[model samples]
Target: MNQLKLTVSILATAGLLFFIAACAQMGTLPSLPASHPEALAIGQQVNCAECHEDQQKGTLKPYKAFNHSPVFVKSHRFYAASDDRLCSTCHKSSFCNDCHTNKVQIKPSTKFGNRPDREMQHRGNFMTMHKIEGKLDPASCYRCHGRANNERCIQCHR
Candidate 1:
């Protein structure tokens, strides 16, 4: 009975110590802010490096990763997929949904035409260009056209 009581007391003390350590560690963990401290201009191009040359706090990636350069914009899908928590800092979920939804209501080319940096697959004169592009990369065409606008492609692709 004494041995069991000692074991129980040790376990209770160990649990209390673990709980205290966890509470102390919680304060050291990184946390994201609700919103940016500064207001960004609407529709203006964002260059994270312009303001933050160093690595952003609480994020694994450097500010350069978030820059809106042509290369970054063109390959944003990969970056966004890898760690979208960093993306939520500056952009709303809707910002990505605008361009990435399965059934695109408005072609990005039309919706964000003013922003030429964005790479829209079927931009101006796509009808004329698709024949050559399709031959080069048929998979790209099938990805979106396979389901979204099957009727249009079926008329000719079949």
Candidate 2:
């Protein structure tokens, strides 16, 4: 009788461990896409709430308020517009060229427009070589990385 009880207890313990492991694995899994059409469409809509749900709800909020701030508008600009051109509006070539030219290194050999390498007279755009080894630079990232962060590239690209 004692042996049977011990065996049952062992089985129960093993089952509990397996259940916990499964739960942990599930948490690590990527979230599935929205099932409903409306939900998927809503996902495309750029809003402060979309990225910063906690901040919007006033629970575990990162930023103080979402109003009357340049960051808020900046976040919306990239999300709603879905293009780098919006960024170029305020951050003119002069601003970018200052940092990119001075701090960052560029390769002049790379050709941008039509006409292959040294084929005909064409504009040669310098290529910036900033390697993203593993992690991102916190300082450089803060420009767009706001309270609510979305990893989906398609959200903005598409």
Candidate 3:
């Protein structure tokens, strides 16, 4: 009976320690700030590696992951979709809205004409490319033009 009581006490103590540790971890949970501390220069390309050498604090993704290399500029959608919370820390929703939203008044290629380093859709002779691209991945076209600008597309497609 004494051995049984000791075993029960040990189990109870172990469970209590685990619960406390979990609660402590929860109390000190890591979270990102709502915005960057300082305003970044307009049109000045940032090099994150210059300032930050370590991986991101809460998440272990490398700081270089945020760099706007041509590869990153082209494939940013996948990264954004994976964790837009990380993107929001550095960029305002309006930054993405400029391209992704229906409110865009000017074409992205025209608006970012000065920023040749940044990739924009329909950059050069898209009419020729779209014929091939549309056949390869019609869903890609539908993402932008399906509901919003189908009228413009139907004018040509139909």
Q: State the lDDT of candidate 1 residue by residue for 1-158, as single tens digits.
A: 99999999999999999999999999888876667778887666578888888866764678777777778877787788786877787889878766555556666788888986656667888778888998999876554444555455657867
TM-score of 2: 0.22
Angstrom error at residue 37, model 3: 1.6
**lDDT, candidate 2, residue 145?**
31
lDDT of 3 by residue, 38-81 (tens): 77766655666767776567655787777766677777888898
Ranking by lDDT: 3, 1, 2
What's the count of clashing pairs in each model shown? 0, 2, 0
As for candidate 3, its clashing pairs are none
In candidate 2, what residue range of length 10 has the lowest lDDT sum? Answer: 119-128
Better of 1 and 2 by TM-score: 1
Off by over 4 Å in 3: 1-27, 102-105, 124-129, 143-149
Q: Candidate 2 on 2-120: residue-level lDDT in tens? A: 99999999999999999999998886565322331232232122343555465532132332343324465445434335433433433355543322333322222232233233222
Index of the highest-TM-score prediction: 3
Candidate 1's displacement at residue 93, Å, is: 2.8
Off by over 4 Å in 2: 37-158
